[model samples]
Target: MSTTRLFNVYCDESCHLQHDGVPVMAWGAVYCQATETRAIAQAVRALKTQHGLSPAFEVKWTKVSPAKAAFYLALVDMFLADHRLRFRGLVVPDKGVLDHDRFDQSHDDWYYKMYYTMLRPIFCAPHRYRIYLDVKDTRGGPKTRKLHEVLANSLYDFDRKCIERVQQVRSHESELLPIADILIGALTYSNRGLASNSAKRAIVARLGERLGSTALTRTSTFATTKFNILLWQSREALG
Candidate 1:
């Protein structure tokens, strides 16, 4: 690991759309020093091997099952315990409440706004970042580019210097990305009140328990590196 002072942000979203028939929308990211990424991926591969699952298997929230409860739980434990890895989630409790028309912004613009909310708190001037987003389809590339522009505008990085690059990559290609998927899935699931999968329900419960609160739908004003969740609103809360 070099002393390059580089950071990597792995971003992903869950149930993000205007009308997905789901009430909640979540965009989240996992942050770590750039140098630690390889080590983290290797550790996750080892964990998969420990569970007797293929290291190549793509881990996702839907994969949670009673048969592999221990494996998922251990993965949660690893994220919580690892000092280098940090999690931040931005959840829209009710998408129906968002009136983009009233705000005079398009849905696409709002999408970038939520992404910026999910990222702004972690940006620092001295350190540069490379943001990797999970590829969902052809739209993924365009969305990634638009997000970079919005981020640069908000950061006042006119030269596009602070944010080194924004990219789209396959989920299986990056180990830490699935972590974002799993965490965001737990968040959206808990908010949506889905309990069909007892194993997933338990895994989400473990996440809430680790963060020392059950009311994850409410924003945590003061959060540490272990787990920080910001439940955002389209409008400002009354003071």
Candidate 2:
């Protein structure tokens, strides 16, 4: 008689490569009740159509431009207004400062660790989750398996009842993945102190305004459930 609720989590990352030239790296996830996934995605497609864009059009942060600002902003507003959806982001302000040698771990090991840290808070007992990560590269399959193992082990869910599965997915195939990209992109942009793209800047500002924060550069309080952000500081930075 376990009345466990099932949830679907869509995850995305921005500039997570070890030597990607981008100093800031961010990972974000947008999750909702399993039953609502289809309706939410259809609503997003409807908004695209209302904005005169094709329903097949992908909503992406990189594609945001002055011409599509209204559409993108409306998308953000829609996400905020919907109580069913929730976002959590983890920002690594500076990857260059990481000392892998000292930690006795490779960059990939740390990468998975960061993913675990970002996701650990979202898991609660008596609730099951299926996580979908946007495929990043050729290692997507192996990464997914490793992440699944890590999460399941960490949670002591050896039977895989709580953490049901972690799978790789194409961002274009999932309506919710792009939303994660948008939020992660904003965190990365803000942390990198970039101002080259006016459209992106506006989106970041609007997100902060909607969240009642002056900036997205800072870590949101732990109590923030709607759009939670964790500005992760390395041991070196903390020292």
Question: What local lDDT does model 2 show for residue 165?
Answer: 90
| C-alpha TM-scores of all predictions | 0.94, 0.97
- Residue 23 lDDT, candidate 2, scale 0-100: 88
Report how far off residue 222 is in candidate 1 (Å): 3.1
Error of 2 at 41 (Å): 0.4
What value does the lDDT take at residue 210 in candidate 1? 78
Candidate 2 lDDT for residue 44: 95
Model 2, 1-239: lDDT tens digits are 66899999999998889997888998889999999999999999999999999988988888989999899989998999999999998999888899999989999999899999999889988999999999888989999999999999989999999999999888889899999988888888888888998889888889878886544777778788999888899876879
Candidate 1 at 180: error in angstroms? Answer: 0.3
Candidate 2 structure lDDT: 0.90
All predictions: root-mean-square deviation over Cα?
2.2, 1.3
Which lDDT tens digits does candidate 1 get at residues 94-201?
Answer: 898888888899998888888998899888876789999999887887888888998998999978878989999899999999999999998999888889998898
